[model samples]
Target: MKIGYGHMGTLTMVVELLLEELGHEPVVPHRPTRQTLALGAKYAPEFACIPFKIVLGTYLECLERGADTLLSGGGYGPCRAGMYGEVHGRILRDLGYNPQVIFLFPPLIKPYHFFKKVSLLKGRCSWFHLARAIRKAWTKLTFLDQMELLSQTKRPRELTRGATSKAFERGLTYLHQAKSLNEIIEAGHAALAELDQVPVDPAADPLKVGIIGEIYVQLEPFANHYIEETLGHLGVEVRRSIYLTSYTRHDVLSTKGDMSSRSLAMPYLNQKIGGHGQNSVGDVIRYAKLGYNGVVQLAPFSCIPEIVAKSLMPYLSKKYGIPVLTLFIDEQTGPTGIQTRLEAFVDLMEQRRAQTREGARMQTGSAV
Candidate 1:
């Protein structure tokens, strides 16, 4: 079986590992681009969210490349994500590409159901092989996440603006091509080491900002116009509120973790509003308390959950005394417009920081 799946942030890497272990050839869709968006938007419902459009485009691309099986994560909440697979499958059928569609939305609450879903894909594999596949995937994920996080720090301080990014791309290529768990680990270390050697201003006090929004835009650089890297280029430190490893381990695999968003967003949103709305609200508050200079919320244009969260940004900004910038993105978005807004936001944060430090010094002098 040649398995193909739409990319969902870092989950694509993990899923690719699983398909290979299951004795199936993994069909990787082309990386998202303007053309990808155009293809997806051409056939997608006019009002569907960006992720749906992009995933559909990916599937179409995969189908053209001879992928016979398509996989998508199933959703169970009020979020449109829950119904994407069904919609995508129907779209594919209508377009004459009747690939085997698999939705990995097995009931996480029911072990038997989850195992059953796994067994179908495993074919003739033993439990041991399944476990090995999972372990290797998890290991790769850990390494990749670490390398990514390290790159975030280096992006702002590196002497050469895009050096860290280049090194990271190379490292990712090596990590992805590695055959075994040990090789993956070695590749990760090598990647980190290469990034570490990049010249950086150790004393650079870059303005720190936390990114909070829908998980897809927050994690997918292409989807969000590479907002994080843009911030770094503008001399801002970036921290995303969600990472795939933590999200998978805490939210999906285990139930024991401090979901600070639930508690932090209580004043404004007492209940889950679906998607990562709670995380959006809570993470902004958390970043404010952490002394971050500012917060930026990236949401897809017309995304209901993020739209709801965006409405509450003013209240959070006023309460925390921090600046907030919310940017809504769509295929029509232009990089020039995004870059201008980001530059303005960075300038605003720098001015605010200067005023803050000046006030602190004035207060100290008055006391003295």
Candidate 2:
């Protein structure tokens, strides 16, 4: 089946792997652009989150590609993601696209009680094949995610530009070409090997920035304009609080790790915050304790959870003594605006750095 899907951050890569195994060709939708957002907005529910709009655009593009089906997770719970698939499906049907919808995340008829509503791909593939595919893709996805998180702490600046990306591209290339599980295994090793050697400046002062906000906007480069790279280009230390692997693992497993640890479980947010709520608060606090100078909270225009975070962030800033910047994105969001705000934030952090050192020296002299 020829299908299309949206970017739930790096999960796209893993899903791509699974689709290939299922012999279902993935017609990757165009990266989020002004056009993509516009098409999505046109058919999307006004109250639905922006990610829904973007996903609609993806399906619309796939229809243009003559795809026979669309695959995406059904957003559930108090969060908008749970119901997005059905909403988008109706929108596509109205647009005259009759493609089958493969809603990956079944509708949760009852909270903490899954309803098993995979109506589309219900009988398409063997259960064994589907489970195996998920296992393989998830295995690679978890390792890649953890490695990336570690890279952020161990060498944030260098990996930012093209190092981590180069490794990822090379790995994906190999993953695409693999015909056997052993081949996938070999490609993973090579990918990590390439990733392990990214460059970094040992003397660079850690001017940490916490990434928080909508999951889609937090991870998608096309939607967020390669935000991590923008921070790295300015020579500011980047502290990542999100990764696809961790998010996926959190979804399946318990977040029982330490809140005090720098890279501990995302404990601050066990209960879903109706969308990026707890993550926003946790990132701000996490960055503060990790000695970060700034936090960047991303949100699409009209996202409720992030909007909630934006409202309460003033307290987080006052409590932590760290500055926070909110970037509300939409079709009109350009790389220029993002860069401009990020530059100013980093500049302020630099001043904070200067003041901190001056205070340290003053204390020493007073002691003398």
Candidate 3:
């Protein structure tokens, strides 16, 4: 089987590796581009989240390239993502393309069904081989996430514009081409080293911002207009609340630690509202406690779960004393508009931080 999946940041690379190891040919779609978004938006339901449209477009591209199978993640909640596979398949069939669509749900929720689906793809590969392949992919995923975290910290302080981004991309390329576990480890170390070498101003005290919202928008640069890079260019240190590794650990593996997002969110949201709504609320509170300057919520227009989270933003901001900016994204969301809003938000954070420092100083002086 020739398998195809959507471009989801570095996660795509991991999927590609897994498919190859499973003895299937992987049809890697190009990263989401303007044309890709247009194609997806054209066929997808007008009200569907932008991620659905984009992934649909990705599948269309894969089909055009002769892919026979489409793989996607499924949700088990009120989120619209649970219906994506069915909807995507129907749309493709209507358009006269017949491909096998597979949706991987959380294994913890339906282990038997999940393994049954996995068996279909494993084919001639032994169970041991499959396990090894997954281990390798997981390792690569961890390293890829580490590189991203390093880039987020370094990008804001780098003296040369785009230097950290370039190094980060180079590291991604190296890791993607790596054929062995040793190579993967080497690539990860090399990538971090290169990022560390980028010249940065020691005196630069960049504004720290936490990103929270729908996973798709948080992870996909195209979906969010490359907000992380944009924020870094504006000299803001950005940290995302989700990554594939962490999501898998907490959501798929069901191994929530004592300070899990669900636990942290109990004060604001008592239960899961579907998608990452609860996590968004929890992570924002977490960031505030960590002294982040602000938090940005990215959600697709009409995303129900995110909308729930957005409704509580004002309350969260006021109680936490942290500024919150929510950006609703769609195919029509333009970079210029996002950039302007980001600049204003950053300025607001900066002013707020300065005032906080002055207040602290005045209080200390009065006591003295």
Report residue 5 deviation for candidate 2 (angstroms).
Answer: 1.5
Q: Output candidate 2 Cα RMSD.
A: 4.0
Question: Which runs in model 1 stand beyond 4 Å of their true positions?
Answer: 106-113, 254-258
Consecutive 10-residue window with the lowest summed lDDT within model 1: 249-258
Q: Model 2 over residues 87-146: C-alpha lDDT tens digits?
A: 777878887878887665532233233334332343467778778877888776765675
Which tens-of-lDDT digit does each residue in 1-368 have in candidate 1?
88888876666877888889889888977678888889999999988888888889999888888899997767656678778899999999999888998776635555686676678889898889989988999888888788778888999999998998898888878888876888878887888898888899999889999998887888778899988889998998898888888878656665322278768988888876667777788888999999999999988888888888889999889999889999988888899999999999999999999999999999999999
Report per-prediction Cα RMSD to one decimal.
1.6, 4.0, 1.3
Question: Which stretches of model 2 miss by more than 4 angstroms?
Answer: 45-48, 106-127, 150-156, 159-168, 252-273
Better of 1 and 3 by TM-score: 3
Lowest lDDT sum, 10 consecutive residues, model 2, at 256-265
Query: Which residue pairs collide, candidate 2?
Result: 75-81, 75-82, 75-83, 76-82
Model 3: residue 331 alpha-carbon error in angstroms: 0.9
- Give the per-residue lDDT of model 3 (tens digit) for 139-223: 9999989999999999999999999999999888888898677887888788788888888999989999999999889999989
Per-model TM-score, in order, reads: 0.96, 0.84, 0.98
- lDDT leader: 3
Q: Please, what is the whole-model Cα lDDT of each candidate in the order they appear?
A: 0.84, 0.70, 0.90
Quickly count the clashes in candidate 3. 0
